[model samples]
Target: MKIVSLRVNGAGQAFIARPGTTLLLALREQLGLTGAKRGCAQGACGSCTVLLDGQPVVSCLVPAVTVDGAEIATIEGLADGQVLSDVQQAFLDGFATQCGFCTPGMIMSAEALLDRNPDPTRDEVNEAISGNVCRCTGYEPIVSAVLDAAARRRSRAGEGAKL
Candidate 1:
């Protein structure tokens, strides 16, 4: 077993994992963070998406050891003290989720897109979440949620609100 240290959801975390262990497995089985789903374990599905250093990544495709020293953000870390992030709230308000299995990954992907481009166009939003396959929401609500979240973020920033 190898000991890896990384920042998870704004907190420092360490875990002992085998060399071939995927990040998804490490997060779920080792760290007890089940937010990253175990969808297509081959990375074809975006259900296991997470943010690695603020970039959306397929956790199932990434080896746990490869994330050493990187900052990993899971859906569990998006909220603070019972307050949901703007993107999460938008998803809820827009009814973007259906079965909820894809919500975590979709949210993380949307968060990464917004982090880089707070005001993304519809095409960009679609491109950002393209990897995530939501069989339930049919992609319309998800797109709307991202756009709504971006607008909300801009409004909050205009008011000098801190994220």
Candidate 2:
């Protein structure tokens, strides 16, 4: 086993990984961060989505060795203490989550989208979350939640403009 170092959730973390260990396995099994689920081991499912170097990627498909010393952000990193991120709150308040198997990936993708475009349109939101597949909720609520999160982020930014 070799040690793989990473900046996960804005914190430094190192874990031992065997050859060919996927990031999803390291995060879930080694680090005990279960937010990113292991759906299809293949990249076809977005359930293992996480931000790698600020870009959304399927953690299940990424080898731990390849991402050594890289920055990673998972669903666990989206909250502050007991408070939730805008996307997470939007998901909960908007009832966008059902079954929640895909919620973490969906939220991570939405977070990445809003980080770049805080005022995205409905179509943009749809495109941002296109990689994520939700077996329940039919994606209407998910899209709406992403749009709502954009609005929330924009509103929060506008508050700073008043200062």
Candidate 3:
């Protein structure tokens, strides 16, 4: 086992990752952050998605040793103490989540897209979350939620602008 340090959820964290440990394994098993799920153990499924340096990446396919000192953001970092992020709120209020197996990765993709383009078109939203698979929701609600999140975030930003 070797110790590797990475920034997770804006905090510096260290964990022991066995040889060839995947980031998903370290996050879930070692860091106690289960937001990033382990699905295919390959890059095909986006269930293990996370924001690495503000870009969405399939955590299960990422070697823990390769991402040392990287900034990782998971679903756990989306909300404040009581206040949820615009995306999180949109997902909840829009009923975008069903079985929720893919919620975290979906949210991370939405978050990255919004960070770069606060107002993304439906096609953009679809493209952003295309990697995620949610058998329960059929993706209609998920797309709507991402668009709604963009609107909500813009409204919030406008409110801040006026203040």
Candidate 4:
């Protein structure tokens, strides 16, 4: 077993996992953060997406030991005191999810995109979330939600700058 220390959802956490354990397994099994689902463990599916140091990464492809001392963010961390982030709210408002199984990964990907590019074009949005596959809501609503979230974030930032 390998001891790993990571900051998850803004909380410091330490756990022991098998040497070859993936970050996804470590989070779900060791830390009890099951937000990142295990889909195609081969990294073909983005169901295991998470934010590593504010960047989107397929947790299934990351080794737990490699993530030592890294800050990770999952779907559970996207809300603030029960208030959803703009991206999450946009997903709900846009009805971007059907089964909701892929919602967390999609949201994580979109959040990463918006973080890097506050104002992204449709093509950019597509490129950012291309890794995530949603068989339920189609891709239109998901793209729409990301675009809406970006706009909302820009609007909020603008308002903050005015203050």
Candidate 5:
């Protein structure tokens, strides 16, 4: 096993990674961060999505060793104590989650989207989360949630609120 270090959720983390260990596996098994699920292991499903260096990536397809010293952000890091991020709050308020299997990935994708584009059109939001798939609560709710989240973020920015 090789030791891999990464900055996750703004904290430094280190864990042993066996050969061929994917970032998803290391996050779930090694670091005990199970927010990113292993839905398809094949990277077809965005269930294992996370931010690597501020860009969204399918964690299941990235080898742990290849990303040593990278900055990673998972769903677990989206909340500030009990306060949820704009995307997360929008998802909850908009009733965008059902079964919740795809919530984390969807939220991560939305987070990346808003980070780059504070105000996004519906088409842009759809394109941002195109990689993620939600079996329940069709795309409408998810899309609406993303749009709502964008508004929330903009409002917060106007108020000088911190995310």
Candidate 6:
């Protein structure tokens, strides 16, 4: 067993990761953060998506020990108390979520995309979430949600800039 340490949702966390333990398993089983779903462990599905140092990656395929000291962000980190992040709020308002199975990963992907590109085109939004597979909501609303989130973020920045 290897002791892997990382920052999860802005909190410092450490756990003993047994051999071959994926980041997803560590997050779910060890840390008790089950927001990132366990879908295809093969990394083909984005159900276990998380942000590693601000980059979105499939947690199921990421070895826990390999990412020691990394900064990890999951869906749980997107909210401040009762206030939702712009991406999450956009998803809720845009009706982009269905079945809720893929919502966490989808939201994480959107967060990563918006973090990097405050203003993204529809094609960029599509490309950002291309890895995530959502069976319930066709990609239209999801794409719209991402774009809307970007706009909201930019608007917030604009307000901050004026201050």
| Best-performing candidate as measured by lDDT | 6
The all-Cα superposition gives candidate 4 an RMSD in Å to the true structure of 0.8
Candidate 6 regions exceeding 4 Å error are none
Q: What is the lDDT of residue 61 in candidate 4?
A: 94
What is the model-wide C-alpha lDDT for candidate 5? 0.93
- Give candidate 3 regions above 4 Å deviation: none
Q: Which stretches of candidate 4 lie over 4 Å from their true place?
A: none
| Model 6 agreement with the true structure over 1-163: per-residue lDDT tens digits | 9899889999999999899999999999999999999888998879999999999999999998898999999999889999999999999999999899999999999999998899999999999999999998888999999999999999999999999
Per-candidate clash tally: 0, 0, 0, 0, 0, 0
Worst 10 residues of 5 by lDDT: 154-163
Which residue pairs collide, candidate 6? none
User: What is the lDDT, from 0 to 100, of the residue 4 in candidate 5?
Assistant: 86
Candidate with the greatest TM-score versus the true structure: 6
Alpha-carbon TM-score of each model against the true structure = 0.96, 0.97, 0.97, 0.98, 0.96, 0.98
**Candidate 5 lDDT by residue in tens digits, 14-56:** 9888999999999999889999999999988899999999999
lDDT of 3: 0.93
Candidate 4 structure quality by residue, lDDT tens digits, 37-103: 9889989889999999999999999988898899999999989988999999999999898998888
lDDT of each: 0.93, 0.93, 0.93, 0.93, 0.93, 0.94
lDDT value, residue 154 of candidate 6: 95
- The better candidate by lDDT, 1 or 6, is 6
**Pairwise TM-score winner, candidates 3 and 5:** 3
Q: Model 2 off-target regions past 4 Å?
A: none
Q: How close is candidate 1 to the true structure, as a TM-score?
A: 0.96
Q: After superposition, how far is residue 69 of candidate 4 from its true place, in Å?
A: 0.7
